[model samples]
Target: MTSATHRSAAEIGRTATGPRPLPPLGSQSSATELSHVDTTLSNGLRVVAVRKATVPLVEVRVWIPFAGEDKLHPATAEVLAETLLTGTARRDRVEIDAELALIGGDLGTGVDPERLYVTGSALSSGLPTLLDVLGDVFTGAAYTDAEVGRERERLIERIAVSRTQPRTIAREALQKQRYGDHPATREVPEASDVEVVTPERVRALHAASVLPRGSVLVIVGDIDPQTVPGDLERALGGWASDRSAPRLPALPELTGGNVLLVPRAGAVQSQIRLSAQTVPRTDPRYAAVQLANLAYGGYFSSRLVENIREDKGYTYGAHSGFEFTDQNATVNVDADTANEVTAAALLETRYELGRLGLVPPTGEEVESVRQYAIGSLLTSTSSQSGLAGQVMALASTGLGVEWLQEHPARVAAVTEEEVAQAALDFFAPKRFTGVVVGDADLLAPKLTALGDVTVGEQD
Candidate 1:
């Protein structure tokens, strides 16, 4: 082998080779402006448009900040979100789907406590029809009694199916234990909750929460800013504005020193999730934490992957992430291993945390993470749809376009010290609430020596 191969093998995995040269700008690269125009119609609808002359497609996204924030029960918001797509005044469910199909376009909507987004994408040539269809579905929906009943049944079926999936059950249990009685803690609404999701309730929610004035409209593709804004205004002219922001209570911080475990009897493998509150999107530590996460277990080549999969073949892959939100943050590390190795895998993961924090990775390891992150960011923002997604997030959070553009520099600016500090902040296995979906009788004794393991059935 060459001297280069020898050096690579000897190098500690914590150092970067050298600073990366910036990529070229202009049409040769994704250096174009995130040009957009913002206006409100006479009826209080807010309209924003971004022009991307390269792709032959357009994306329209409508956001509602209601599902995850309200003081209502945890599952109610998600049930309401699922109910909206059932049918409407102008078209039944089949007809609505057929219309979107004809243009090769797609219609979709999602809800979290903090926001709801109804989005669609289509060829640029089909923008007018797509926008018209969305306007009809969102603003002019009938919310009939028959449709509401049908949707309620469907949501019930979904909840029933989720119980059989080990991974799904584990996640739901984790959210409940982690968030406690907080509104965001709950998973999907059951059939009984859906029974109360009346047409009147959905309609009331539409009026009170789905404010077009607070909404963001994104048009990306071969569209002109000057022309696109007018079309959006015409389409959403009837949408009402709301000056008042949705009232969301502060999320309670996680309390101390307990490990939560959900055990599934007779299961061959254990699915584990350990999490804690971390940093928010607007926090300056966001970028630093992001890079640090990439090195820990966020990436395919992260420390957990090397230890769990390479060094000891415990599972396919182990990873961690920092999910940033408007108000709260979550840093979770997830992995799945057989009952016998579950305890060992968890111990190894803890060791990695200590090594990354207490023994700070070399400069090379840090640079590798930086390069991988920035490179991924560059590729993801190459399309018109991608650019529009970035813009929508910025507009919603009131972050500037420059923030997106400067992401690479910020990531590159992260020092080894910051990464070590982030590691120290996030990785405390002793504080983790562990969920193990496996043959609990066999796994409990093995895991108890590691920490205080609370075992409960998956039901």
Candidate 2:
């Protein structure tokens, strides 16, 4: 019964019709509260057990302050971290792997200038087995000749490869400029030194610094909180040592200076690494500083990224963020660009830094960054593994579950004026000092033209 006078599809689509308006984004709410029990073992082992029953799994994080005070310690500790779990007195590498696999668990180890870390996860019921094996490896690792030789060679090779990277050169140069002969600057040891480390040296270094008396452990899982502490105490009781009788010396304070140009021969790219000391999480101003950082260069849509990456096309990425150690905190800004525009990029970078502190963020900008900060904090700890890592890392800095549960409110309460004040106090261009790594011959003319650059020792 329909008439045949209907227009074609293209003709019918010519009418002027408006689409429906979308709803505005809702305001941010409070983050999820983390519930956990905190206790200390008799031997000075800080233990925090968080109850997360979303799945039948557990995450364990053990952090040891293995301060590499000398070249020997740094090289030896590097080898030790690689070979620690390869074997134990009772369990060879094969036995250890099989034992962990049997319980649906896995283990990994890493060492930085500040600490040695052992991280793993397992089914909730297998927590006891996981702890037993970790204890065995920590207390009685069998550093056999074959295992030490193999791991040492592999580590040396990796270091050689890493040293060739421009970012690695920039990082090392920046570390030296900041810390200056301090042990904290020796995160990556010389390959020649690592090649000379013997098995006996690794065993001795382990005996000296890897003490349970000065470490912390965190466990998050679907288990009874009342019984988990007892399980941990019994499993790790015998890992006692008086070597770290009091504690390792804390990191020294860092100072900043003019940019140091580190020469890399015959290169076409430059890496800019910037650093400045900042406040710890315990400071009341921390929340405000976090928001200011997000607005400036702490996120993808920040002013620094917009200026350098999007607006000017000087670099592919530009970011600024914070780094926290046991007793020290620092802000770092990083960017890489083509050889010809290195000076221009650096100039724009400094200009943005000044602009952030001087003009500060408006109320709208502050609110956007505040929401991002709160949302990220909540999302990071939503999973068992993520929560365990967060709590454990904070525990090492003397923060607790109370801080984690309450930081969102602090971030939410930060006013625009406070964010502006934090920016002015901490983010001034004068506060930062760093290095520029590139081909010296290619970069020397323009970099020298930029002035305030000194020739630094190159890798």
Candidate 3:
């Protein structure tokens, strides 16, 4: 065998010079305008279809507002989504699966506080079969007693496992800390409540909540946009009702307040979740705010991550991003740290938040974040599924594919001064409030000493 020679890691990383300079980033190209049609069918469902013939596949997304005020609505809705396609009057569970498999398709449903979502994909040649199967489920799902009972037991087990997870606990604590008693806070249903849900109740809830008037349907693939409305009318014409889907009640605006320290005894790790109110995507200044958010903690190379994770080694990761509910939006920051360094992590986290507004990002930093934002948007919409998801999200907010096509220009036009102003307006530390969950006995004294922190009882 011939002897092999290789350079050391450090030597390989550098050129003949002491260090190498990275090549300048290339100018980003604008996204092509997608051919699309947005229209309302006779049944009152808004359908948005886009033609992106990248592959021989079709992606579908349906969003229906499914909010309710009943104490058991969450559990009922959860069970309803799980058993939605288990059977229909024309087809049983096995037959439905067989039909979908023949078309290289799969479908699934999920319900949150805001909406019920049905998402699926199929071969382009099988588009009609896919839509027919969907229409059958939407209009005539049986929610049979046997299927309901089986899924209910499975869902209860899943909930039990998820409730014990640290992230889930932290999320629940954060929602309660911010929203108090709003319906939007009820993301996960109670296991006890799910145990009580019967087939009859699920059927009744489906009948009352699964209307299409205020809902949106998005389809993207190798299909003609002009003819999609006719196909949808033929498929979903029976899914009609005079009453529109019920919208969730408006959430109370979040304001700065004391951070709550929630005790989790014997836990070796802690979660820090911070929140502050901010503008939605429709706001004229949103482009600047988006860049500012990326520089602060929205990306891996953000200030918060550099301070807490890279420099101080207090957490593995840290992030900040916007959470939109209907027309309102808020920025949230999260990090997980060991119990010993939880207080230190919180201090550094707050320090970065304050610094983002006071010091602000320079021109170099603004350009870096702007490039990242535009690049992410382009990459996310380059696929059929991604395009469908983006369109669905925009349609839910009363926007369309045109908004996505024009977004890169908006980000490119944002100025460094505008980014600084957005940082000052939105990223100030005093504008935030949140929760830290850990072994309160160990974390209490240090966190309370940091100011604006109070120990609270966990439910």
Report the CA-based lDDT of candidate 2 relative to the real structure: 0.86
Scored by TM-score, the top model is 3
**CA error at residue 223 for candidate 2, angstroms:** 2.0
On residues 35-108, what C-alpha lDDT tens digit does candidate 3 reach at each position? 99999999999999999999999999999999999999999999999999999999999999999999999999
Residue 427 lDDT in candidate 2? 86
Task: List ranges where model 1 is wrong by over 4 Å.
Answer: 1-32, 38-48, 68-80, 241-248, 428-434, 457-459
**Which candidate number would show the highest lDDT if scored against the true structure?**
3
lDDT of each residue in 1-459, candidate 1, tens digit only: 655534553354434765444444323133446676666566555566777777688877776556444444334555557666667778887887888877778878777656778878888888888988877876777767887777667777887888788888778777777776665555555556666766777777776776665566667677777787678778766666645336345666654345556767788888878776777766888878888888888888888899899889999878898654556677888888988898898778778877777776667778888877777777766777777777677667656456777787788789988888877776655545646667778888877777767777555
Q: Give all candidates' CA lDDT scores.
A: 0.72, 0.86, 0.94
Cα distance off (Å), candidate 1, residue 297: 0.7
Q: What is the overall TM-score of model 2 with all chains considered together? A: 0.93
Model 3 per-residue lDDT at 169: 92
What pairs collide in candidate 3?
none
Tens-digit per-residue lDDT, 88-198, candidate 2: 889999999998898899999999888899999999888899999988987899999999999999999999999888888889888888877777788888899998999
Residue 351 lDDT (model 3)? 90
TM-score of each: 0.84, 0.93, 0.98
